[model samples]
Target chain A: MEKIKSIIEVKNLNKSFGSNHVLRDFSMEVVPGESLVILGKSGSGKSVLIKCIINLIVPDSGEIYVLGQNIRELDQDQMDKLRAEVGFLFQSNALYDSMTVRQNLEFPLRRHWTKEMRDLNAQSAVKEALEDVGLGHTIDMMPAELSGGMRKRIALARTLILKPKVILYDEPTTGLDPITAREISELMLQVQEKYKASSIIISHDMNCIRMTSDRVIMLIDGRNYISDTYENLQNVPDPKVREFFD
Target chain B: MIHLIKIDSEFLREVGEIARFTGRFFSEVIKPKQEWEEFINQCFWIGFKTLTLVGITAFIMGLVMTIQSRPTLLEFGAVSMLPAMVSVSLVREIAPVITALICAGKIGSGIGAELGSMRVTEQIDAMEVSGTNPFKYLVVSRVLASTLMVPLLSSLAIAISLYGGYLGVNIRGNVSWHLYWLQSFGALGYGDFIPSLIKTFFFGFAIGIVGCYKGYNSKKGTEGVGRSATSAVIVASLVVFIIDLIAVQVTDLLGLT
Candidate 1:
């Protein structure tokens, strides 16, 4: 039997801001179609780790390979081309406040899709993505008009419109109430099942972690302290790991 | 002494950052794949939106100048030169500077606040992650729009101001509309009009660039947005005056004064 290859590979990544180091010689990988969670407290560098993978924050030193290409070696145009294959859902949703829902969904298509492609299929694509997120009726509303949960769903819809091979989620349920949080978690599962897209979710919400994670990586003190299933992590005797389950 | 040195260095660092930001604008502006749609949108907002404020201020300026200058000219027995005096002053100096100052308050603060809020919300980061060049789309379009629009606004202000001067003359004297316009145009030469018009482009560029630079670099969230907007107006207004002073000197050197 052939072994499965990793979709994303980070090796000895290090990052620092002035005298404060955030990620230190940390490394991880995401296999195809896996939902891998980076679990840590706020300010524990989980967000920094994922941002480094997408090249949003340049690592001070190390290598990041996405889809088998070394990101540091790519030029701006090349990086942009690579970015089309990766979707990032920001914590704040980052929806363009100036645009309506349809326009917001179409914003990414403006650059990645050709005029002919858009003229032929853009409307259907927008509708399909919105339907996937259960937000088909919000096609004309402004982002400010949507409830918090709906805004998150619209943001996820925008991410799905590209049909990316990988999705990087930065705290998908941080501000939502528990009910809405679970809904978003279930939505994450549906996306994975429907699209078969691998994801790196940076989150600490145990409910979200347990529901969405195939495996969890414990990010502690700027390093990957352990990697295991959420159930396995719950049993780990290490006090550092036990603190979370306790 | 150490505290003074630190302050000086901090000031120098800010100047260097702004210079670097201005240089990046030139590099991105000349690149292909210009954002013409956003540019047109910005022109509509930066130009058309501020027309009322600039027009009203210019009319008042011309009317007040004409009315005030009457007594002085009467004492010199040169009250008949009112139209020429008012038109020359409006076309050569008052209209452009006042219009630019107004824009520095309105357009400059507006751009700063909008971009600063966007930055705080991570909308800029989202644009970059979507494979779009945010600088090219946002900064270049706004800067170019302001640079083009300020001169157009100033030209409009000059015309409206001359009309106000005509009205003022009619109030206290009997100069006909035709004769008033004739005297106004007769007093102006290429030197006065061209130099004044040329200076407004620099004024616009300064306002746009300063606003963009502050907003793009704003941090610490909402409070930082307020600071960016306030500083954009303050710095752009000062730069407008500085540019005006330099334009006058250059015009004098060219024997156009």
Candidate 2:
């Protein structure tokens, strides 16, 4: 991968729920237009790491910069502004089950987008994102009505509507069938390529890691098992790292 | 003896947990960016959804109270004062408090279980990772909604309950609708109504906060959701009564009676 300007900078991050320390002195940098796949076990704090950067879970102590904005220092209004620039694909599709696909996609855009932007254009953006994820026709359906794969696809579409500069995926393919997972990984790659947006995907799926990653790193034991390529990661002697692939 | 002591200890611990949870809710109320939407939704759910139930309950409560109190008033040859007594009782005390108690059961458990499941299932985490402020979106909205909505619901309940009392008065006596309302309002002053109305806000706040706290801080997965929901209603109901007692004492002390 070619070197690019850093889009997200995380430094000396530490978090604890009471005494159960989750992320300890973790640090990583993501470059503009890079697709960095984070590989970690369930409790290795993969979700927490991305959550901290996105200002979902504030770190007890650390510095986080997303697209050049220091998250910890930013106020609520600033954080809301920063959120509009970042998109997240939650692990469970978090599609507001009560709402239809069109409504789900419209939620963030409606809340954050200005009034001058036509509502029809917003709907079109949703349609385009859904079309990009191959769910263009399913927009009228509710999340509960969709299959697991379709739900994930709609979730991905919702993430796209914001036209975010930094997109985060939390276990994007955990529950999908192999074929569906592959399609999603492929879709993610397409998103990165098409939008030229930086993506940080948190997944334990080896195929997902290999297929979508321009750079891959493993979150292990509260620290990052930093590796630039999927090929280099096999050299990691840690049993957890080996088990991660096996 | 030892076994009995262990049972007593466990019961005490349960009570302690309830108190601590209730205290935490009060602590969090002043926090900012309260989820206004969730609160509004709760108001809609608790107050609006339960409208028919509250109306019927209040009506029956009033009817029953008037009928129940009529015998005593008649024994004293004060049967003519039945309308005035029922009105004051229903509006000033029974209506707001009873309406809130019902709300605590319905709204408190609903919020507790819903949020607890969300916590267990990681949907709340999903909200966070998506750059959505979970506290502001979930807690703030819900608590604010309950706080504002419960008072409004109580007002509705009070009115319905007075009407029920009227129906009860007319069941035997020839009290007209205007006469009943006038006598009810005459017996009830700002002193009676304000204290009771004020307590519903506390009741709403209690339900919202306890429910959210339990849900937000749920544990043990599926089973935890049930435990939190059940405990929320129980604790919130108890808190409503306790607050009502305090409000009564304070109002009486101030000679607002």
Candidate 3:
């Protein structure tokens, strides 16, 4: 096997809400260009782990290094700059409801790209991104106007527009029907192939996990219980791991 | 009395939270030094869109004040004083206070609901994780708009109110429109106008900050959104009255009264 670089790494990540202790000594890593899914039952602190990776919900006592810089050492400006290279796709699709698809895609460019760069490249960048999701024609439509599947696709497109090296998907397939879920799962694969961006998907959707994840980490009891390929983990005899499979 | 003297933890917690939130607002507000388009958009939504409701309420307030004061004035042979009295009260205290209260009900709740929805939907989180400053884009613009717009809206309401008072004066007597406008202006002085106008900026700040705080710190779920909206209006309206009380005392101290 060829050597793979760990693009993202977490060590002893401890986050607690009061005495609830959501993420305790949790640790994981994502290698470059691989799709890693953190599988947990709802409220198993999967979201917290991802949010901590992005420095959204700060972990109580642990370290996270994204790309190269330690997230805690980086100031707000640096964190924001780092965020541009790490795309977060919310489960709600969090598409700015007031904005159209084009405006939504253009939003990040306005913030990250200088005026001259945006003036020169924003139009084509937005169109190319939309086309990547097969929704180039829906650019002018409001987020409210799009169906759930389309909104999800557009959100992925918006995430891709930044050409992020790390894509974080929080339950990307939670609310979709079976068919839409499969489509989104397929889209995730296509995104991984096309952009070659590493991703950490926080979900329990078996189909999505099967289709997109190169590796799976089961977040159990605020800790990384098991880390393995899907085929290997499914065949394990441990009840905790097998519970998810059954 | 002993219980009242002892500070409640919840109240102290809220005060601390609000102070910290206020500090963050001022801190973020200075720079990267831009958000003009969002600011103008907020002003329209928070200021222009609120005109109709405020206008109607102000007009009716002036009309009622005049009508209510007439019979009492007649008893004292001061019927001619109706326009002056109505205009004075409307501009000095009633107009700003009433308009602010109405705005607290409308703008405060609207901000609470919208931001609450955004917070719950993770739109605010999306903005943050996407490397956008939600505070500058959302909080500061809305706060600045309210601080700037409430006074203008209050002044407009007062003018409409004075006209309503004129109609009220005409209902029972024969006060001409020109004479009514003259008396309306005649009754107001620097003492009456400046304090009322000044206090409204405080009122606007109170409303905007309270609404944003409630919404921004809202708990998870749809129920939390409802609580945020309700708590925003309640807190904003309560602060308006408190601000009015303090303003009155300060004006008295300054001999503006």
Candidate 4:
């Protein structure tokens, strides 16, 4: 039997802002087709850890490997090329407020797809991605016009349009109502099932974690404290870990 | 004394950062895959949007200069030289500076607020994560548009100001439209028009750079956006005056005065 290789790896990551240490020698991995949730209290450096993986925030000293390439070694153009294969869903949903839904979906395609390729299949691609998120009717609406949940779906559709090998979700359900949050969680599962793309979801929503996570990593005190299946972690006797379950 | 030194060092640091920002703009501007469509869109907004304000202010300036200077010229029995005097002043100094200052207020604050909010909202980060160069797409396009448009706006303002001068002349005395324009053009040489027009490009660049710098580095969310917009206007307006003063001195040194 062959061992599965990790698709994303972070080793000895450390980051600081002024005197505040956010992430300290933290590390984690996501294997192919895995939904790994980073569960932590607010301001426990979960967001910082994921951002370091994507190189949004430069870690003080660490190695981040994504799809067999060391990201820090890549130049701007090379990093851009690598970025096309990794989709990031911002916590704010970060849709271009000035652009309509169709244009927002097409923004990433502008960089990754050739004009001829886009002309040939861009419409259908946009349509299919929107349909995957059940937002086919919002093809022309401005982001400001959409409800919060609809905006989140549109943002997810934009992420899915690239058919990336990995997706990073930053607090996907932070501001949504419980129903909407569950819907987004379900959408995340559907996206994973449909695309088979591995994901690192940063969330404290236990329901979302239970529904979407194959495994959960407890990020505590700027480090990866523990990793286990959600149910197994719920039964752990460690008080710090039990604090989360309780 | 230590506190004073810290303040001085902080100011110098800001200056150095702005110089670095300007250097990045130059470096990125010449790279291939230029965002021409966005540049044109910015040109329309930065140029066409500010035309009305610039034109109105210029017309008022020319009219006021003509009406007030009438008494001075009449004392010297040179009231006939009113058109030439007004044209030279407008072409050499007034129109470009005033138009640029107006843009510093309107367009500068606008770009600052727009980019600042986008920064706060993480749109810029999203652009970068999407494999797009946000600086090249946003900063270069806006800077280039303002650099090109300010001079064009000044040129338009000069023409409008001259027309207002003509109207002012006719309000109290008789000067034919043809003669008013003829006298206005006759007093102007390459030296007056070219130097003033050249200065406006710097004015535009300063405004664009300052606006972009403040916005791109904004923090603390909405309050930061407001601060960026306010400071962009203040710094851009000051830079316009400084650039104008330098242009005047340089032109004088070159004997273009």
Best by the lDDT measure:
1
- Whole-model Cα lDDT of every candidate shown, in order: 0.94, 0.83, 0.91, 0.93
lDDT of 4 by residue, B1-257 (tens): 99999999998998899999999999998889988989999999999999899889989988999999999999999999999999999999889888998999998999999999999999999999999899998899999999999999999999998888998999999999999989999999999989988999999999999999999888999999999999999999998998888999999999999
Please give the range of 10 consecutive residues that has the lowest summed lDDT in model 4 chain B. Answer: B92-101
lDDT of 4 by residue, A168-225 (tens): 9999999999999999999999999999999999999999999999999999988899
User: What's the CA RMSD of model 3 in angstroms?
Assistant: 2.3
- Order the numbered candidates by TM-score, best leading: 1, 4, 3, 2
DockQ of 1: 0.82
Model 2 misplacement above 4 A: A1-4, A16-24, A60-62, A118-120, A226-228, A235-240, B1-43, B121-132, B172-183
Instruction: Supply the global lDDT for candidate 3.
Output: 0.91
Question: Taking the tens digit of each residue's C-alpha lDDT, what string does model 2 give over B9-108?
Answer: 9979866875775565556567664655556666677668878877888888988998899888989999889988887887778888888888888888
TM-score winner between 1 and 2, please give it.
Answer: 1
Instruction: State the displacement of the C-alpha of residue A131, model 1, in Å, after optimal TM-score superposition.
Output: 0.6
User: Which has the higher TM-score value, candidate number 2 or candidate number 3?
Assistant: 3
Q: How much DockQ does model 3 earn?
A: 0.78
For candidate 3, what is the DockQ-based docking class?
medium
Residue-level lDDT tens digits of model 3 in A1-246: 644468799999999898898888988888899899999989989988998998889889998989877999999889999999999999898888788899899988877999999999999999999999999999899998999999999999999998999999999998899999999999999999999999999999998999999999999999999999999999999999988989
Q: What is the C-alpha lDDT profile of model 1 across A67-135, one tens digit per residue?
A: 888999999999998888899999999999999999999999999999999999899999999999999
